[model samples]
Target: MGESVAWVAVDWGTSNVRAWGVSADGGIVASARSEAGMARLTPEAYPAALDLLLTDMAIPAGAPLEVLICGMAGARQGWREAPYLEVPAELGGLALSAVEPLGTRPGLSARIQPGVCHKGVGSEDVMRGEETQLLGLSRLLPGFSGLAVLPGTHCKWAELDGRRLTRFGSAMTGEVFEALAQHTVLRHSLAGDVVESEREAGFDDGVEAALARPERLLSSLFRVRTGALLSGKSPSWCRGFLSGLLIGTEIAGFRNWGGDEEVPLIGSTALCALYGRGLAAIGRKSRIVDATDCTLAGLRAARELL
Candidate 1:
């Protein structure tokens, strides 16, 4: 690679696209982002969106670009699908090379990283892009072992043995919350916003209810609505109650299936706080790490092998 060639990092998920230009030492020299996410574009439009981003970011044509992308953009429906490397493989084993257009430019090169998958005991789960974050976490928290939770639309509970991803599970907590708040009968019982104090108060209650009977999760969710309408609880508090219930249930279910006690949460600050409060309510402690940094750190780690 030429000394002046610019290395690029991308974290393209279902809802967002982010890119950064990095120096040899991995310092971000420039960055850009957009909403042209995987869900919004057809296969043919993928190259167009990338072109626009590069143009908007003023990445000059003819400048050699080495790109590493993570997230859903590597899924079957996204740019291209990357195959999962089974457990016991090093992070480097996750690498896959595929060419993508550089905007409208010809002869440009781009590469997408594959997600990870696990199957066992009649259950299986997969994660796109988050595996990169897990690798980043491994580097950031050297010698760290046990479970790391990446919470978002699809929550990822990853088991790490050193730098390797041993196993993982996914929870659709965020999506479920969105559907309940917008489309379900429970919508009437929740407020426009979730109050932190109320979430704190009901955090443990939610976790407890979830762990009490795993099969009764649906019925327990209905109780949140009933508690609001019949018992005269504030709609806002009810929202918090519902939040606690779902998150708690996730925590409880994972714990039942062997989630580690001391977990590292990787996500936004707000989600991390919510998770922290829920864990506290359940008498568990956790460490919080920034998902964005993890994304960049992961891309940087992957670039080292290029």
Candidate 2:
């Protein structure tokens, strides 16, 4: 089969961008990834950046090539503000709320998918690209209804009621770990990364401890330094313990808000594995789903709606 035909799917984020030339039958024909994400581009430069990324794709010259974009590209400060659709939002109907950005050349027809939001009585929360992944999960599983744990700098736990997002919450577990490891006194005690290879390096112990007493998290965090200063703990062990403590705390907190026993874990494989470990320690299990697969599938679902 020659490289040619129909539309595109672009997942644009703060640090990187990925574009896929999709065929009519929902297969990817050509793809490209670049560092020209929302952080690097000005409003007027979006069209040019997209054009540059699609340079090698064999889209025929004539009618404008359709491009569906998601993520930070739809942020208020992005190319054009694709307003947030308030939850309970319909995953299948996301395409109906797309917005078009300005300065598009005649050769391209681009639209941005709006993010999802939740407005409580006083506090409010929002999500950008993850909604597509939720839609993809729904599409991929046909009728999946459970708690989805999307691990990231800001971990999101979303409740999917069939194809609609009923409610969700975020936990700054990763960010908190970073801050504790880098800015706090724990810096001297912990390793630069989380537990990756070893098994019994203090991770499970920390998880169990935190699960039992999440209310003592602030004090528990400081104990990392004390463990190194007094008992001569290894930095690697301290890191694993700290990682597990934070993740386990996150899981414990989610339990308060509510969660399912069999959770759908999304995003980075390594991070999800860490979360899976924490969940397992608390009698819950998780199935990891690659974020890329969900993104592509979601774009297809949106394209179908369009």
Candidates in order, TM-scores: namely 0.90, 0.93
Across residues 1-306, which tens digit of lDDT does each residue of candidate 2 receive?
224557889999998999998887888888888998899989998988887777756555446688999999999889999999999999787788999889887877889999999888765999999999999988887778878889998899999987799888888898898988899888888755544443346788679889999999998887788878898777777888888889888888887544554788898998998898888886787889889999999989987976
On TM-score, the leading prediction is 2
**Residue 41, model 1, lDDT:** 81
Question: What lDDT does each candidate get?
Answer: 0.76, 0.85
lDDT of 2 at 244: 82
lDDT of 1: 0.76
Tell me the tens digit of each residue's lDDT in model 1 across 110-146.
Answer: 7888777765657777888888898888778888888
Worst 10 residues of 1 by lDDT: 96-105
Clashing pairs in 2: none
Shift of residue 237 alpha carbon in model 2, Å? 0.8
